[model samples]
Target: MELLQLQYFLVVARLEHVTEAARSLHVTQSSLSKTIGRLEEDLGVPLFDRVGRKLRLNEYGNKFLHRAERALFELEQGKQELRDLSSPEQGTLELAVTAASALPHILREFRKKRPHVQFHVQMLATQEMVKLLHQGDVDVCLSSPAVEEEDIECQVVYNDPILVAVPKGHRLAERTSVSLTELKDESFIGVKRGYGTRDLADRICKSVGFEPKYVYEGDEPARLSALVEAEIGIAFIPSTARNSRDQIQYLQVENHELVREIALLWHKRRYISQTALEFREVVADYFKPLT
Candidate 1:
């Protein structure tokens, strides 16, 4: 069978859940199921037995697991061993993130140190990152903290204290920060549903005992910033979004210690490559993101 087929087989075996495995792998469940079926046909034996909707590894499957794991381990070891010979800095790091602020310095330093290594970065939602780690589609992810799911292990990379972005002319800009009570009647630009930012925005508003006036909503970070510059409403973004903009200013909320913690996540069961670990160190040092 192909390497991909074996990898998929192992993922399915670990999860014993086709749907979750497929979602994590960033592939359709039907496709993965077919791949496993083809693999079983080639081997003339089934690795899984479906009991209603659940899957269990049969005796034959358990017997094959040791061999399969050995093979996978050897394959990875081969790649790791040959890393030095492949190129100057060798090996590839595939990482995905949800925003732009946390990228620049880390990327520059990574490329500078490992010019031969390659990078693949994707901006994704917090849940998407956790799913990909489970399926092995990506090795690492950074996003907002997800508490409800115990399946995904996450560590805080940076605690992003939520900052208020308002146009300079606004009355609130005179203060260091605003509070939920202070901004109860103030116009607000809302983050759209289904996005990771939306949850934080909603929670902050709810704490004030009032729904925010929705000036606008979208996936674009720039659009929301523009609305704030136009003074249509105030927007809340991570402190990192604070940049040199004359028309716009960032302020802290009064007595509001609300922090939108950005986290680095991975499947606790998986082993991270040395190269990936190096990258994590650089990122951790890059922002030195405030706690």
Candidate 2:
């Protein structure tokens, strides 16, 4: 019934190991177990099914977990509201981002405007960012291929063209633009499937009646320029990520509107603090010139 009990239960439910949960919670294993037992007694039902050292969340636990998360989120929001009322400009913004290339500029501008404000940023894939937003774990997100879910306010802040990057002397390098069909047989370098850019490229390539022949698949989009410079493979990179200093040639995708819509996303029902609002404004203004 206590808030602490719910907190402990949620951690245990997530980890599914009493010892691991206790260690993470920084509490004794016996104390954590006792608290969970008390919570089950109060609820008149067991939340987890015991199997050796691993504790699996039962059907009851699954149902209760959502309610527990909502209750805790509301309580935390109330506390944050009180804190914001005292000093509206000085607090942390919980932000998630899939559009990593645009973050440095946005954050630099944001810091200049609100030096007292702090940021806790998570670099996540598109689906991961969307999940965190729905869970209320992140106050806001800057993502690509804008989320289309209901109850989430997603606005396109920038439309960055996707370009094909090649080594300086490659056959396609001299060309101003190349079609996906032209590069159907060429080796490609790409990020992993979960990434928004990679997914977008796959969809676009498929539409053009070809699948990209990826010679190298990596998690870091930042490495694309370097990889292309090394002649490892050509890659589909966003315009914002292109650097003139890199020894690579960027080509436009001919006859295709291959642009990624960089978006700002937030849950419509979640509490929005003054700091979050200011950060949102900062993002909106940062992309104004680019738009």
Each candidate: RMSD: 5.9, 2.7
lDDT per residue, candidate 2, 84-156, as tens digits? 8998768889999888887889899999989998789988888888898988889999998798988799989
Worst 10 residues of 1 by lDDT: 80-89
Clashes of each: 3, 0
Cα lDDT listed for each candidate: 0.75, 0.91
Question: Which model scores highest in TM-score?
Answer: 2
User: Which whole-number lDDT from 0 to 100 does residue 65 have in model 1?
Assistant: 85
lDDT of 1 at 176: 76
Q: Compose the digit string of candidate 1's lDDT tens values, residues 1-291.
A: 889988998988899998888988999988998999998999899899997546789997898888998789778757655663565357778787765566776789988877877779877666676677766678777666543455566767777777888899899777776677777788878556655566777776787687777768776665777788888898887777677778887878776667777767766655677677778777777757454
